[model samples]
Target: MESDLSTSDYLDQIERLPTHEREGQLFWKLRIRETRSQLRHLFANSRLRTSLVISLSIVFWIGLFVLFYLGFDFVVGQVGLPGATYHAQTVQFVFTLFFMSLQIMLIFSSGIILYGGLYASNETNHLLTLPIRDSRIVLYRFQESLFFSSWGFFLLASPMLIAYGIVVSAPWYYYAYLPGLMISFAYIPCTIGAIICLILISRVPHLRRIVVGIIALLIVVVAYTSIWRTLDIKDADLLGAAWFKQTFRRFEFTREEWLPSTWLSNGLLEAAREETFDPGDLPWFESGKYLIVLLSNAMFFHVILLWVGGLLYRSSYYGLNSRQARQTHLRMAWIDRITEKLLWLLPRETQLLIIKDFRMFRRDPVQWSQFLIFFGLLMLYFANIDRFRQHRQDINVLAWVNIVSFLNLAVVGLILSTFTTRFIYPLISLEGRRFWILGRLPIERDAILWGKFLFAASGSWLPCAILVVSSDIMLRVSIQVIVIHQFICLMLCIGLSGMAVGLGAIMPDFREQSPSKIAAGFGGTLNLVLSAIFILLTVLLTALPCHFYFMANESKLQTQMIPAGNLLLWLSLGLIGVVLLTALVTIVPLMGGFRAFRKLEV
Candidate 1:
């Protein structure tokens, strides 16, 4: 009997040992192989070699740096009066506040990313089944999340930081310090984001709806406060002016002074100033105090992550996984009934397909929530047009209005491109292994393709049109300009939607389950690059004629080179060219996509 007990104990001990001890090494090796495979595949394509891709990426980044530098130089030249050196401090403070707000945004965005798929990935589930320690898995995921979230911030900040250095003419050491500051600054947000995600996943698995509601309320509150503070218009009398003065003078306390972003900004600004001004009394590295603060805080947060990860990672992961088992049925029967009633005019298949897409979109909290946050913020900004008009009365109101109206077209185009790439581009790819079901259906490939295009175009058009028309109305532009701008926006929407759907179909990644992962692939990159190029060309074509007309009216030399009649003819030709370009961009990709889909054996 004692020997039997010992044998059973030995067996249990063996079972407790890790199933795949070399899994960590295996994971990295697979990653390397996948990267190499992608590179080989990219180079295999005749149109896009590895060298060409690298060259273009480098050129694009350099162009961005140069453009931002020039813009900064122009702004500083305009605003940097000799006696206004005190304004430098104000600039630093404002930038500090901006970075702090961005960090807060990052925290929420990271939590969403974690909840969306990172923690609940297939690999993570597999890992949990092994005998490996849970802390290691948490650590690995945290590292990956940090890298993914921080790299974009680093790329964006690089140009702006370099531009600041050039503007200040800082010394070499200041340039050296800039990268360290950015790195440490990035780490703070990443750590905070991880902690927030961990807490939410562990403590409140069903918190998404509550959090989204809170965010919506906060957005409304912010919009209301901004309008209240800025809309202090009154009668042109003594009481009115006094009321405005008093409102403007009301003091408020803020926590910006203690924020890490403030520390980073102060450190960088001080270092730059010292390099330029030669403040001899201060010791070397005295300006390094804020840098020290940033680094120390980053390190402290990282240590906290390790501690929490070691303690709660296993239990939290179990909680998270268990919560996934409790499925909630969506009460979308009303939606189906309404759709059936409303779409009686259309064919059954088309109506069913549309309804399916709508239900899929509505069911995915991650997808629709992101959509709400992005467009909601835009709507909030648009809602404050009255304040913008009130504050900018010192300028030529008509010209300002016209300029804003023209710029609004570009902004709307960009927003549409983003929406298409994020949502529309992943539609076909997201069908996954179930695509065979679609193939067996009686629906034609062209019908499916056109449905996606039409849906995407119509979905994007309403918001774009509303924002554009509202801005135009606020600007009080002429009826002719409003009609022209609205037409341009419509064309942009159609073209962007077509490009996104076609490119998505051509390079559908059926293997990846996550939409974000699919969108991060090569096809998505190409879609974005093409969309940007198209937007640029469209804007240039439309804006040039407007510029000529505006110049002809504003300047006295208009009659010499071109008469108003000739200018109108030129403008008409330009509009025609724009229409042709938009049509071509919209049609070619869709045709290619249809052919690609038809050729697929599945």
Candidate 2:
């Protein structure tokens, strides 16, 4: 029947065939059933986990809302900039710039998610054996990938928009239109991302890592130059009204109509004015016209993806499977040699395991690429610290600098927690059904766990410490502040790594093959919750002395004398508390994980 009909009618003919061959419908039906089953199972079996995740999400959302509310309030209250026009235009430019940058991120994130879901997944491989068209599987996986790619967008955007709505006295409908607008806008980048991932895999198939690396480098360079130029203003008043005007003017190029982010931003801005786009008049809105553009473009992409996506997925799937194998030598022995020499203090078994894990990490573009992008962005921000802080003296300067330093520490710690949860927590689980082979090896199970822990701790610490130190140097903070930050960085790395490794053993998901799937499971969620709580305690304990010292110094900037003895006493207490806390957090989980690993049947 499919052959009898033209290509346009192919889908229509599928329904007339027997239900068993109705792969498209079957896939979706199965998906629906699976979703319902998973939700039910989650609520029935893991109420605590469900409640904790939801609660953290709510708290984080509320925190973001409050932060934005205060920022918008500062602007509208005539604190940050002058004039109502400056307020509106500045915020509007911010909205456009923010969404435009977010759009770029979604494209990259969506591509990565799709690459993992499509070409790299065992599930995709299994699905190929079924009767479904490869496109349906791509669509199926796209649904999952979209959720992973876009959740951050929703989390970050919703609160800011709400704050904007409240600040602008927007109608109730602004909040109502918000979700729909965001959903539509999200699809635009994700579609572009899907197309990019498709072309890369189907065309290059090999050399993907090199090509992706070069492309990523170019984007970073472009972003760096753009940001550097934006901030490299000379002779302009750093704390002047003109600075706001000139800085935001550079982003005016994105205010054009054709861009989806522009439409989204303008639509929201207009909606706040209790108006819609008039298309022909001087009114700010498009009278829901921009919203309609988003919806229509989103729909167009959805349809296009189903058609074009299927063809690309089919070709890539078959081509990848049938591609000829090439024999090439890996030039990474130098890495092993260097690592072995550095880790010579450890036993040979543990050293070998560390080297193995290192090789695996270095070989996988997916893992290391994400690691670089996230840390690279943070370091890039740190490098431009002078842009944010003027190289001048002022009342309470020491206090403000002290506060910012601790905040940067907390931020770095938070980001490190995510990496540990995503990558470290899944390591043992990724070992999965291969444990029997490992059991037969002469290496001890303790060595296996220690190797992972050491690998995570040592690997994470250097970069985090460098970032913290670099930010401090840029801020021109005192030597005492830098020394404290370095100490905290070391503690955070060890504690967080141990926590993830420990939790992985305690809640090993041997059944799941995908690292992401494993990471998204209960263990990863629990690990994140614990890590957050741990970071909060660490920051509070370690920062109290520094904060106190700065407040005193700020109170008497001229001939100031905070007693060295008193300062030393407080510092000692703080260090002791932080060290004890770090010890507890690290040792407890590791011991638990060690016990669990020892008793495993495999």
Candidate 3:
């Protein structure tokens, strides 16, 4: 620890400190102590019973694990697929890829979060005025950040491991599972923390977002390729002997070269086959590949921690302390000025809301990241649709595709509603004491709702509709299907946007205006569930017509169930859909918003 501290001072050039620098150092130490005190107070607070909630949550999660374990155990026992001759090598390969990919993603996500502006705020500015060693403060905060990030990683990985163990039904010595899993999970927080630290230390800070994005994309691709045999395009050309060699290629790779996922998988397999793996036959198993992988991962994390202690602490501290360059000009071009003038047609209040939503969106990196995620999902769906095409015989694949496409659009609409809500949901709440100021004004409640709804519709639902349309066209979907799908999707967007407005109005909570809290709150959950139910109902209605169309086509138009009556019934369903959509988009939300405003505290 002393050597590390000395090395850090030398590397950071902190020893040649001026008089003011020494004073600033003392101030920073005090700030660190104060921040630690705040953390302690938060933990001790009666209102924040985090431990109790966490314990209960863990117990509930364990119950889920038990259920998964029992189910997998039954399936494996009944199928007997784990038998020596039963080689699910492809599945194993895919599983290994997915496992390693998840580990990478978790690490990457943690890195971004740790590097992000979690502590780079006015609060941190004040904290920098204390007396502690800069390295000590950084270490403490890094550990705190890890504590927050690690729970999510554990939740994601543990159930899958438990399910696998149940399926493998390995013997008693498999109790070595706890240590192995722990070692595997260590990289997530460690690597993330290290990456974040390094990025901070490096003055080229703008590259951080790009680096995080690349890591995320790489992980996504790795996972996808691992899970889908079709994605393993290179392997497709391999012949019988080549395929066998590919399966046993682990022997050719060194322990360092192998991914933690690969090692964990190999370890699990070896442990499962301890009863059968003969050293003379399979030297790979006897080579202790798994243990080596685990150790390497653990050691790598420690190296990262050391780097954080040395380079990161001072760099991050300075970065947090510095003032960012501010825009000097409030000037606009002729086109921009014209656009603003056109936008000014809306009432000043409504325009304000629109501007606010746009500003909030522009300020958030997380919101922008959703575009990447949606793009990925779109690609995956396109791939699956192509796969489905290989199986489409006599079916008007267009009709079915429309159903699936609109269903996908429906999900997009719902997410858009949710995403936009994160910004606008807190708008009324952010008004705080100014609520009375608004209430005292001549503005009607309905007008306020209308203003909010219009802003949201323009920003959220409208853009989602455009994106879906663009994607549909890009896929070269049939024109007729696109027209219908677009119509249905537009209707869905209206409904979801309206739902969001209503929910925000109804469940207004100024005190809990944080986006994350809003997402987790009962209001948000309720809106999500309702949106899902509506989407489900729409799917059922649309699917019935699709099913009838497919069945009629397949049967050579002989005894069609979709006759005149059924056709009328379908049209009637469409009419009902319109009415329900109107209700969802306009009436329910209006009423909800009105009620919420009436109950809203001034």
Candidate 3 residues 6-125, lDDT tens each? 899786765554454565476568668976975675477623334544554566567768876776566555545454443345435544665655665456445544443234434444
When sorted by TM-score, best at the front, the candidate numbers are: 2, 1, 3
Candidate number achieving the greatest lDDT relative to the actual structure: 2
Per-residue error at 43 for model 3, in Å? 16
> Each model's TM-score?
0.84, 0.89, 0.66
Off by over 4 Å in 1: 1-37, 44-56, 78-84, 223-255, 275-284, 307-332, 336-347, 391-395, 547-561
Whose TM-score is greatest here?
2
Query: Against the true structure, what is every candidate's RMSD?
Result: 4.9, 4.1, 8.1
Q: Clashes in model 2: which pairs? A: 276-285, 276-286, 276-287, 277-285, 277-286, 277-287
Query: Could you tell me the lDDT of residue 173 within candidate 1?
Result: 71
State in Å the error of residue 531, model 3: 5.2
lDDT of 2 by residue, 263-375 (tens): 89878876666433655543234537788899999988877877777788878878877888877777658878999999999998998888989989988777787777777
* Model 2 vs. true fold: TM: 0.89
- Candidate 3 matches the true fold with a TM-score of 0.66
